[model samples]
Target: MKKTILIVEDEDILREIVKDYLLNGGYEVLEAADGNEALSLFEEHEVHLVILDIMLPEVDGWSVCRRIRKSSNVPIIMLTARSDEDDTLLGFELGADDYVTKPYSPQILLARVKRLIESRYSTKHRKAAEDALASCGIDVHFPSRTVRLDGEMIRLTHTEFEILTYLMQNPGIIITREQLIMKVWGYEFTGDDRTVNSHIRNLRHKLGMKANLIVTVIRSGYKFEAKR
Candidate 1:
């Protein structure tokens, strides 16, 4: 089935441009002029991804994204004219999967949309397989996508689970950011290294100090170091 994308931009021209580009790319596209309308449409449709502009009439994209994260893990890519680092970090903190600056190439945006859709679906498949793996205390089970601490179950997002699984599967072997991005994100992430760091922070936040199962390998990468 073709993935559905919701484009939320108050500018009529940009909205139509994105819609047309996505439609040409073989995706089902939905458009909303503001955050309120976008949220309503989001609630009504089975959208696979969201392209949200930061500035909106009813509500801003950041708030919209926070609200959405409250309920779903659907991939969101924020659009903004401001290139402020703080804004970008804030977006990531709110669970946006990616970001694109304004005056952006439509083709680049379309490519990002395609990648997000593909990654989300691919991760779903990986999760199903990972859900069956065996994980001992503070251990990761790659094939089953399971995490266990002291023989208890732990919940992780698809991205976090994938990253941990990769690390554990290669136990004691350090993997670079590029490799981790390819494995967990399903694409060559050209963005800052902080993307990986931010996700790791999130994984740690969820796993707590028990997450020492994953060790930062200083300037090289991360590894799943089983405690002796």
Candidate 2:
């Protein structure tokens, strides 16, 4: 079955262009001119991915992204005219899977959409290799995608979970920001090192006392050290 992609943009021309390209790329496309309509379509359809514009009528894209993230981990790629690094970081912080600045090539957008969808679906059937990783009073369970520190369950976002899992999987080894981006967000990801730093910061805060397990290595990256 062809995967469905939701395109939410207030700009009619841009929305049509994206819809055309995605349809050409063999995806079933749904179009929404505003955030409210986008959310309505999202709730009604089995959308596999979303291409959302930050500025929209009624509700904004950030609100839409946050609303969707509250329940579904559906892949979202944000489209914004803003070139500011802060905007990009904010989009990621809001649980967006990717971001594309305005004047972006439709082909590149389609490629990112395809990559994210593929990555999301490919992992859906993966069985847990090692069910759990326990160290320093923190336990991470792969099957349930849950984490516990000192026997208290900790809530982590999808990105945070992946970052922690990757670090825990390679204890004592220095994992660079670039490596984390590639592994956690996939090789197609184009964000800078700040993205990794942001997630690491959030992960550490959530880890609390166990946060020290993720040690920063000066200019390099970070290492997860299990308590001896």
Candidate 3:
């Protein structure tokens, strides 16, 4: 089945340009002039991925992302004209899978769309095959896509969930930032270390008492080691 991509941009030219690219790439394209329309379409369709602009009319991208995350783990790539690190971190904190700045290449944007869609579906397959991490009191329920610490449910954004799962899958082994980016983002990461660090920080904050399982290796990367 051809994946569906929702494009939420107030700019007419940019929206159509991305739509043209995604359509040419053999994916179904949905256009939303504002966040309200984006949310309506998302609720009505089985959208595979979303390319959402940070600026919109009637509503904004951040609200749209937060609302969608309440019920689904869909991949969301945030678009913004600003290059501020805080905005980027905020996007990740809200469960965005990727972030792209404006004045970017349409081809590169298309590539990111494809990669996120592919990663989401492929992970579904893997999750179905084998699931759950019951070690160290923190558990991941893959089928329902939920995590719990000692019986209390923990809410995590899609990216944070994936990152924690990857670390838990290889306890005691250091996973470089490059490796985490590849495994979760499903591509060679050209972004700086700050990107991964921001996600990890959010993940640890969410994990609370169980956060100690994730250890940052000095000058290396991160590892998950449960101390019994």
Instruction: Give the clash count for each candidate.
Output: 7, 0, 0
Regions more than 4 Å wrong, model 1: 123-131, 137-158, 185-190
Estimate candidate 1's RMSD in Å. Answer: 3.4
Give candidate 1's TM-score.
0.83
lDDT agreement of model 2 with the native: 0.85
Alpha-carbon RMSD, candidate 3: 2.3
Q: How well does each candidate superpose onto the true structure, as a TM-score?
A: 0.83, 0.82, 0.88
**Model 2: lowest-lDDT 10 consecutive positions:** 119-128
- lDDT (Cα, tens digit) per residue for candidate 3, span 1-228: 888898999999988999999999999998999999999999999988889999889899999999998978788999999989889888888888899988899999988887776656654455444766777889888866789988898877668878998998898999998888888887667578888998898889988888888999998999999889
lDDT-best of 1 and 2: 2
Least accurate 10 contiguous residues by lDDT in model 1: 127-136
Off by over 4 Å in 2: 123-158, 187-190
Model 2: lDDT of residue 94: 80
User: Which model scores highest in lDDT?
Assistant: 3
Task: List model 2 lDDT by residue over 100-194, tens digit each.
Answer: 99989999888888777775555555456577888888898776677899999886766677888899889999998878887876656666778
How accurate locally is residue 73 in candidate 1, as Cα lDDT from 0 to 100?
70
Please give the lDDT score for candidate 1. 0.79
- 96-125 per-residue lDDT for model 1 (tens digits): 878788888999898878776765565444
Off by over 4 Å in 3: 123-129
